[model samples]
Target: MGLALKPTDTLIVIDLQNDFCPGGALAVNDGDTIVPLVNRLQQQFRHVVLTQDWHPAGHISFASAHPDKQPFELIQLGYGPQVLWPDHCVQASTGAAFHPGLETTRAELMVRKGYNPQVDSYSAFLDNDHATPTGLAGALRERGLGRLFFCGLAYDYCVFYSAVDAVAQGFEAYVIEDACRAIDLHGSKAAAKQTMVELGVHLISSDDLL
Candidate 1:
């Protein structure tokens, strides 16, 4: 029964939205690869949560909003350096919707983040400012979810931040590498792996669970 999960553990699916999928805006490399595995993993956890990067149309993270700025341009935001993204995941738009094709059987809660036009929220726990919480950590705490298993798009961004923040918030966090995809920003994948290792995030493949 090792790592088979319990009522005290949670499966957190981060940013499984249309804009992050293959062929969508801001699509991650190999983003489609992990969907089926994540869908399958859903059956193994009783408390499953799904996160959506639900940004407004004119989000501050968008380079287009800054006129001369291009996608991936570095910008100064409150927390520190923030990358400008191509316009994506505009709230209430079709691209912001979760992939309906996913097997979301165990998803008990859906957490929506980045609704604020002024801030970009990569971590499911806290917005980049480290000021406003998305309330996810408290939700997990209230539910007594000590062991957090994370999956989803772009291993370099949302998934990584969420996993790191989970551990920082006192939840034992595991990142299912095989259940996550990467944006791979010019060796960022390698860097992200190193960062996770240093953060004490357990890296497990999907096959480890199966």
Candidate 2:
């Protein structure tokens, strides 16, 4: 998302798309359940930003794209161990489109990632290696938003990584846990919560904001 809009303590919506919701190619567990809460939260935050996973068809993250690799299988990328996904989030595909349930009107900026055929991006702030940084932090900083609120889609992956990177980059970060679902890959949902606890990231329910 470009930072052209008036920003107010930027609210980052991470990965709210069809492929991550139920009945899509790579659905998260109970992913659609968070849409209502996210919609509600959008009403409270004015400077809303959204991240979309706009992968090319047969991008490197897909198991099908890599012969001998299978979905949920791990492979060593130049970055490190990466999990292959069921072909998903293809750009312009129905599964890659923003989830219809997402309240898009509130979003002033919608950042699309994972489009690079060679790189898979989980965090809005960085690609998987943490080597490349997306301009989210800089944009938020430019807008004088030192504090950021996060909600949407997979709690364990995008949401978790985004929150961690936000805190690591000196932005106060808040995660609305109730507004996110999890992939729970090998019980990652629990691990993510633990990591947040250890990182001193703030965790709150959507009710806490009300």
Candidate 3:
């Protein structure tokens, strides 16, 4: 039997910005293909939240900010290991905008993360250091929303971190597999899935919700 969505359940569409889609700066593999599926899935949820990767130019996470670093190279920041990324998702830029074809009218909240030039935010709920919050947890609690279903670009990073943080915050967390795509850097996808399972975050399919 399929799982039924409830009023307390929320669908978190994460980082569906132009930069994460094909032909953009930090494009993920087959990321654009899931848009239609995500749009259709959004219709079934009572509460929908959207997340954007809104970074500033010269953001610490960008490879260009480091004199000798290259994209995909890892560097140690005060927050810990940080993956240097190509310049993308600059605030107020085209790449920072949501994918044009994505349906957003139903979203009850839009949480923009990574806006701070000092920190790199992958999880919608918290910054990369895992300390500074995006205020999403409090907002969801205020609305009495507990169960969270996550879907969007770069499943191995943003989606994975968000779902893990959801479980950490005492919410029922699930990741809709088909509605997500992965950057999968250095086997991170497999590793993330394993960690999520160990952490009690459910890995499910969109059909399960449908």
Candidate 4:
């Protein structure tokens, strides 16, 4: 039998934007395939939140901003090791928009991250610096949400980090495995799964939530 969603459980859809989907600047493999699954999952929860990777042009995370740097290259930023990416999800650009096929009318909140030109954000609750918060934690707590179920694009990066942070912030965190796709850069997907397991973030499939 599937686990039932409780009233205190919230679904967080992470970075289901054009740039993360297939045919975009930093496309993830089969990233668009999760949209329909996520749309259906939204109906199972009472509270739904969506996250957007809204980076500014010339953002520090963009490889194009640095001479001789390329996407996926590692760089030492003030926060920590950062993976430079193709200029994607620039604010107000088409790539920054949510996937056209995503059904978001039921979303109660939308958190926009990575807008800071100086620091890149991966977790919806906290920026890479680990000091600045996106205010998601407070919002969830305000709504009395005690558990978070995540589903969306780029599982190895944003989705993974968000689930980690969700547990760190004192909420039960879960990742809907089949409802997400990974970039898997240099085996990041496997590494991320290991890290998430170590952090006590539960991994489940969409069917498990039914």
- Judged by whole-model lDDT over C-alpha atoms, candidate 1 comes out at 0.87
Rank order (by lDDT, best first): 3, 4, 1, 2
Query: Could you give candidate 4's per-residue lDDT for residues 1-210 as a string of tens digits?
Result: 388889989999999999988899999999999898899999999999999999888999999999999888999998999999999999999999999999999998999999999999999999999999999999988879998999998899999999999999999999999999999999999999999999999999888976
Q: What is the lDDT of residue 145 in candidate 2?
A: 82
- CA lDDT of every candidate: 0.87, 0.85, 0.95, 0.94
How accurate locally is residue 210 in candidate 2, as Cα lDDT from 0 to 100?
51
The collision pairs in model 2 are 1-111
lDDT of 3 at 91: 94
Q: In model 4, which range of ten residues has the least summed lDDT?
A: 1-10
The number of clashing residue pairs in each candidate reads 0, 1, 0, 0
Residue pairs with clashing backbones, model 4: none
Q: Stretches of candidate 2 above 4 Å error?
A: 1-7
Better of 2 and 3 by lDDT: 3
**Candidate 1 ranges with C-alpha deviation above 4 Å:** none
When 1 and 3 are scored with TM-score, the better candidate is: 3
Per-residue CA lDDT of model 3 for 1-210, tens digit only, reads 389888788999999999999999999988999999999999999999999999989999999999998999999999899999999999999999999999999998999999999899999999998899999999999999999999998899999999999999999999999999999999999999999999999999998988
lDDT of 1 by residue, 1-210 (tens): 246667777889999888898888999877877888988988878889999999888899999899988999887877788899999999898888887777766788989999989999999899998789999888878878889999998798899999988888988999999899899887888898899899999999877777
What TM-score would candidate 1 get against the native? 0.96
TM-score (all chains, Cα) for each model:
0.96, 0.94, 0.99, 0.98
Q: What are the RMSDs of all candidates, in order?
A: 1.4, 4.2, 0.7, 0.8
Better of 1 and 2 by TM-score: 1
